[model samples]
Target: MKVLFSSWLGEVVDNRGKPPESWSDCPAVTLPDTFGKDRPMSAFIGWGGVVVLNESYDIVETAYKYAQALQASSCAKCFPCRVGTKVMEDTLYKILEGNGSDSDLVQLETLCGSISSNSKCGIGQLGPGPIKDTLDHFKADYQAYISGGKKRPNYHYPYKMTAPCTSACPTGMDIPLYIEQIKEENFAGSMATIREASPMASSLGRACFHPCENNCRRDNVEKSLAICKLKRFAWDYENTHEVDMPLNPNKHTREERIAIIGSGIAGCVTAYNLALMGYRPVIFEKLTRPGGVQLTGIPQYRIPLESLDAEIKFLEGIGVEFVCNVTFGKDETFQTLRQKGYKAIVLATGADLSKGMRTEGEDQGYEGYYGGIGILKKIKYENAEIPKYKTVLTVGAGNTAMDCCRTFARLGSNSYIVYRRTEKELPCDPHEYAESLDEGVKYMFLEAPKRIVAENGKVVGLESVKMELGEPDDSGRRRPVPIEGSDHVIEADCIISAIGQDPDIFYMGDEPKIKLNKWDNPVIDEDTMQVIGVPDVFAAGDCAMGPETLVIASGHGRRAAQSIDQYIRGEEIHLSDEQIMENIIRKIGAYNKNEKVPNPKGWERQPIPICDRDKKLSSFEEVELGYTQEQAMEEAARCMRCYIVGMACVISDSEGGE
Candidate 1:
């Protein structure tokens, strides 16, 4: 974390002339000492300012590259940002070319001020701050370059454009761009931008736990924009207008066939992307219907079957083939798939097998004992009749538990959620928790299921233990400890265990080639999503990353597809420069919750419409009513477009000098 010089956000720490012992660290800023793996970074220039780590780096050329980066990233929304950044780049290029002078320094300073004052967005306003700092603190280096006394250093400057919400998103979605498209009344354009990262817009628009809104800059003003709702608006617009979904022009152009072993979010996303890249992808589902757990584990009230079906139809239109009732280890082994001409295999089987409660009488086949996911499958896929039980107690606090309890409540049962922690520590989304309460689903906090109380092979009640929160555990949540002599029985006819899920890779058989972690999930290279030591086999989704949100699973799917493409083409499986820059910025921290936004308040966030409480509880129907066109536009306008440019000066061995 040591720095030779820094002017980040005006918290200056100049240790250029001091010894290592006497040098002080900058309190205002912190950066990773190394870039990717062990590659040391000499300097980092961004919207804030510059930080010099290695003194040997040519400060003049670094500044010039930073300026060039800014110019290249400019959106040109305004006169000052567009023309001003170009002028700044030209002036720096002149100085780097060994063409004179002292007057140009003053001109550069003036231009920086103008761009900062008049630019429309962060790229224009904050991009000039680093250049201004360099001119002030590293003026001697610039003068040397102009005086023909210094040589340009050979280094590679890789830069990328990113926004806070975009960087925080699991898919690295261009959030601001889509919102801007909505503001411009370009619904199709917004969908196009979203399709760049994911093709499950309709499904995700409904079921995704949107992490982007949590880091939105607009939260500083009043509240975060309705980002998830805005996405739904775009997809709904396309659907309602009967607009023909565009098919990938290069679909099925490639000869190699790829086999994806699940129809869930991860598998579908991978197939969609591969099809777009002209590769023929075939998705295999063991169940009679596709859509994987998204159709079975998740309740119909959250994501309707019709909606998911429409998304599947779109994927089919793009040249993805689906085969139902086909099992992996049973019907087709990894070796057989390769023998059958499948160039690659993706395992996205998902973690649908419910983990045990580790209590007594739970595993025994009792009349009313049900695993959370098992009950949901019977209700959704099998259309099981309503249970006659009056009381239903579900254990766990995740979204799955909420769905189970809420679904039971809708079925006229007295549903209860039992968790070891307090309501404040609930792991489910805030909205899901709130809605569960509103639906008459009760909660028993500070209670953990001890044993399943059954009579004559029929579940009757659940023996629970009072719990107290102790020190934080590895998951960063307070560990729950049972209080002595605090056991009690919660009388109920039905007991459901919704604690957690593990990947059902039983399909992998006993002697699988792919490695698995301690949790039994497939172990793959985190960056490439390729199975460790098995180049032709890739894994993603709940099967690879335990249990995660749909967005994160989709991201894994996208990255795996990219790696598969490179592998088939006989190219190196590596991240692009833009993806590398994304990792760098993410490590540096994108959304600053403490940072103050200059915009004024009073633009309240538009509220999304929902189905009536009584009507929604009467049947399994989609809850959210989505946003109207007027509401969507108003919400989109609240986006600050908080885009920032980040550049890294890597020590390259190439001879080119700029």
Candidate 2:
């Protein structure tokens, strides 16, 4: 087997005046005697080393063969490697075929960097060696391919800022990291990393609003990978199947007791993490069961009761004691818990109270005007009897509205969403909204409910006015203004207001121990989440954050736990700006300093399961079924590890540190 390596460059492997026809023609190029059994000699391609085989098997075809082999042989551990390899090979082919641009060379190098740095194991780590070697030793090949018999572009832009996707994640989750993991079939490892930052890996995987996807480099390719939903796959597996989480032992224990109120995702996570730090932490829940809204608000269809219960059980197993049906302010006061020998108190009572439209006839005999929280509570309780309504109208465009509409559909109610803005302006996730629409929920966009009309002391209809988007509002969303002479009426048997919710602070007396905001949420130091006046009193979760997602609330719990640990240890409770800057620099280091490459292609995103539209609307047995094990493994294969094995350091020989 002989091969002729082609490039405008002078270097070519020649067998005594006859150019080699294949890599096998060159004996000087060493091939490993044996590799993984699944992988054989035919699977190998090109010279494997840069320093050793500097120019052997340097042909682009041989490199392509090696690249393809890697694309196939890779455990698919990380995104950049699994996907990036295919992309890099494609880009290389274009360059070889004379369709290459100056940017193509830059993209090839960028993919090379990603593959080298983000891949897990030897195959990925060494996969890019040939391309890099060719680029370094046979630079003329890349130059000739891109230059089209001309010169390369000058003054490439440098110093691009950190991407927004990575910036928005709380735990600094490698958004791109696990995407590659999904590509690699390393579902277990990917899920383990997710659990490091969040205990509710399954919940977050399904429901997290992935800001990472928004900033995805792939969105520049096609659409961003459904990053959050992919996370759901890993978590769904961990929940359904047994997964191991090795507990990190911390021997240092402080003789302090911390009281965390609510026992929801936030409270439970806080208490669980606190226990891991050797603190005797107890969670107080006002409800009969723990999990707060996770128990009483999120419907069984979205967050299955078994999954929620399993997570709560795991927290309990980890030494987080839950005191259910014990109202913090009602049964025990802040002073009482403190006097009971507790050193700190964490308030995670979520925003469970629904916000009313405050319209007239609301308190009257009108059957309309269902409170958002109240409706969710009813469905979660699993009572057979539901309020029989012919036509139901919901007010709001947030996730609550979507939840309300879905629940209404399951309850045999013909549901319609009356929002103050267009579909683009709806606050709900696009996927959730799409699911709601699929389940037969009608949407009346650019309309707001004006009043609930009733006949003979019974709710009959809803009156709404058409709305037009005006200038950008303070919320950074386009403001919705009523359109003149566009008043509309929607008939309704029951009206559900899913606008929003408010925190109930009446239980906390008018004391200076904890400061309260005008909105009735506890005012706390932004960093510590500790009530300003009450150093020992930490606040987290929905009520603390003024109503956010379960994931953000969990992040709050994690942060508060760390802060509380610092407080108990009498250490400075602040993250230095230098530390923050260094972290930002690390992510920047992950990205290519040069041109951006096209995202890896040839794999479709794992599809979330959905019941038949009619079936979905008629019952509450979870609309979108979770990912199967095979699906999860396929998805996990896509995550780019992004973990650099060895830390980069500057050696100083003068200090004898070299």
Candidate 3:
């Protein structure tokens, strides 16, 4: 990208006096040239150095705005950061007011050094970097402002605060803030902070595949902080103490009723947030209970029933009603819901229809053939009678496959996981894979199912073929290639196909207005979660996006609730400025895995306790015992509070303008 001036991450390219044709491109800095839509970005001042995209940008004003933003974001944790940022902001304002001096320039430089070296967090430590760069590269601009040679540019500066962990989070959770609250022993404050982003605290605390821990800055020093466990601790503390979970003061204040289909994580979170916003939300679930995939697909050993029940009970307390044994498009159509006076409809029916492993005799009426979701639903939800099988083979290598094999193993069957890829390519969580092995679940790697060998239209064995890895597939995983003439049969009385799942949009029932993608998932606005052609209808979770993690689904649910509320209020459905900034920082890459952290090492992550091994294999009891208060506090203290300020200078008429 062409730039007038750039000093990002030690790569400098100055084209102040060069012709446009003779200018050099920025070597390292790569930033968005435009803000929202087509609004040209003048400059970007962030934790990294400055990148001036437009030469007409007023450098002096940009620096002053960045200083002001930095001061506003300061946590006031220490003397150096709080006082130093204030002094910097005051000096810049004085210069902007045409009263600057050479001594003031020198003072600004000194203050930057002090703040960078002594601040308690990244907000102060990295905040002064771009200002220092401006002093070194654009000093004449500051001098011109002070000497009355240049007037104010009045460019709008929009800023946002982010951390490595928060930026990587799908929900944009304030991870550092909540962890800091835990460190202060204020568990309620931490839970409140988490609730700001999501209300599935207990369920997510147990079943969520936490992506925040992977980007934790603490990993540089020791291991990543036990983020997921700490979240569980906060929720467990509130539940065990019998403290009433706080409700939104404006709960049920609004009269418009919203209908949400499916009581999965996405649907539940959407109802929870809408209720908090004073809107009445009714969740329609097909099963006998409210929890959708949590109760149907996930094994009870991972997420306890009581934890999920408590979450639903709290939602009820906030005026969110749950109607069970009601299926969308079956029991109530969109037309029927509208006739019933529902202001908006949310389709959160998760992708629970398990895909079949294309094999011969698979679709035959074999009594033992079952989908991964089907068996889990039968075992966990229906409480149906279990058929005794000598050997149970589950096909696939994802978390569902692990859950399937583990659950069957607990049922006293010789369970086996058959996969086409090696163990290194197993897609399940490492901890889950390890536990499955400990429970005597065997693995058959480099083998793919070819056919289901059945006798008398009943159960039998699974014919397999030897496989090898080929070129990488669309998912970045090597494609499995079957070796010729390598078919073999694995003895099994029952076969569960756990390959994958997709949204069962059969409920849409010939609705042409709601568009769908090639994958049969709904095509909705990514930001607002509003269905494209139908503004009053919204979709989230696996039905909106393809099958994703619980936290991601919850994030979608929160966004959907906001959009639904706006739709009912006759307001524009859009993302907030903070949400826009989050997208920008995410595009710029927040977590630098190779960046050096200055904190001391040796603070090992606390381990979560486990249930008895005997109970783990024989029963569906909870496996992970949540962290105690002492462990939670020690783990929280390991957070480095890596908060940084990001700001953009755009045209006053731009969407990002303040």
Candidate 4:
């Protein structure tokens, strides 16, 4: 094979035995350009004379070229590069004179390190790069000159690393490792692998939005793999069939007792991970039953109570204490918690306050005009007189609004969602909106609510005006403009407002102990989930991040747990949001391998099944059925093992290192 290796100095070698002088005479061409990108060839031409390092080449001649290159390139300014390069040249000439010693090889490595690290210019600094590469990959060539009898080993091509989906997971679940374990029919092993980073595997499997699937490499050919469902399949298998939740491999006693306030996904996740780390984690819940938004905020049909219960039970089984019916400020304050022997406190009380339409007649106190979240919470925790409303008008096009409309429909009430924007601009999940439509829930888009008309202190009708699209707003969606003289009145017994909600800091009290943002939320170092300036206190979930998805909240919980653990252990205290992102990015990784690993081609994403429309509307049951074992194995096999490739090529130097 023809080998052409050249540095900036090797601009002289242009495939000719002699060096090319003028630019016009021999145009500069890359090594691959001289041979071919697909061909088997290697070249190393540095600042001067070329030394082709292919096994078929004459090493004596190449050594002479390397010596001449080193000799011609010594600038007298920098001590390391100027003196080191000349010494290297003298050593090479000694080797060429058949008088080199073992000490010469040691000196070469020392000089390479000093020149690479201490050089002033790019020419001097990167000059040892070729030697570094040679020492690492072609060290035998140097050894052959020194010792004797050097037979070239058989050719072997390096594996190319590639995995996008693994890097996409927020929890960094070692997606490819679990997938590979599944491919081998090792369901138990797969679950163990998943439990390394994420404890809410079952919950995530059932409800995660799966950012990983969106970035799946398979999407280039067919659709993305059913990654979420696959995880659910493994979790379902492990939970229902195998021995319950994952256990702590090494259990030890701990003096540090951490307190996490809130029983939402974030709070629960933090407690679970901390418990695994051998710390006593106690979660305090204000509500009667824990599972903050998971129990009350989210509808039963979307997330079953039993699933949440079983997951929480797992946490309890692993020595995590759940103290329900305890309000943070009323029962235990920040100072009180510390006094009670809790080393650190994690505030993950999620944003539960539902926003109002803020239109006319909103403050007049009309009867039966409740917040969408409040209505859902009531319906979820206990059955209220929902059917008595007869006609429900929900203002907002979010998932909460959809849930409200669906709940009313199940209770045999006429429900309609009045959205300011069109269906195309729906903020809710598309599937939720579509299912609501299927359940006979009505929609009135491009009709902005102006006010709630009342009769005898009761909501009787909703007054709305037709709206038109205008310029884009801060949200990047076209602004809705109300049309003149297009006012209309829709008769309704109830009006439900579900615009949005923020962190309600009322529980913190007017005294204001911890620092708060302009929005009244706690100011936190987003990377560490630590409350800024409050060492022993940390925050997570909706309260910290102003209402994120369940998966995101859980991720925040994990980070908050990390921060709390670090703080208690007297580790690095502060981290900026960018550092938090770097930590996640490093764990998830960018590219598993430089080369794209080949996956099974032309396979369509397995379709997820849902309950029959009649059955779905009649009762609160899980809608999307999880993947079967056979289906899961097939999907798991299609993973292409990108993360395994990444693990195989784990950089010894640093992350992103070659």
TM-scores of the candidates are 0.97, 0.71, 0.96, 0.72
Q: Pick the candidate with the highest TM-score.
A: 1
The window of 10 residues in a row where model 1 has the poorest summed lDDT is 506-515
For each candidate, the alpha-carbon lDDT, in order, equals 0.88, 0.66, 0.88, 0.70
Q: Which candidate would rank higher by lDDT, 1 or 2?
A: 1
In Å, residue 470's CA in model 3 sits off its true spot by 2.0
For residues 1-658, what per-residue lDDT tens digits would candidate 1 score against the true structure? Answer: 5689888777788999898788887776677776666666788888778888876577778778888888888888799988988898889888988995999999999999999888878889889998999989987888788889676777888788899899988888899999999999989899999999999898788888888889888898889988888998999898889676786899899999999999999999999999999999999999998898778988898888888898898899999999999988888878789889999999999998888899899889989988899899899878888567799999998999998999998998999999999987999999899999889999999999989999999998999999999999998989999999999999999988999998887877633677788999778889999988888989989999899999999999999999999999999888887788898888777788877888898999998899998888888888899999999999999998889998888887673366
Give candidates' CA RMSD values in order. Answer: 1.6, 14.4, 1.9, 13.6
The list of candidate 3 runs beyond 4 A from truth reads 1-3, 15-30, 653-658
Error of 3 at 198 (Å): 0.5
- Cα lDDT of model 4 by residue, 397-504, tens digit: 887788889888877778899998987899988768888988889999899888889999999999999999999999999999999999999999999998887776
Where does the lowest 10-residue lDDT sum fall in candidate 2? 152-161
Off by over 4 Å in 1: 20-23, 26-30, 655-658
Error of 2 at 533 (Å): 2.2
Q: How does candidate 4 score on lDDT? A: 0.70
List runs of model 2 lying over 4 Å from the truth.
1-166, 174-188, 242-254, 382-384, 484-488, 576-579, 582-595, 640-658
Candidate 2 residue lDDT tens string, 399-456: 8888888888888888888888888778998877988888789988888777789898
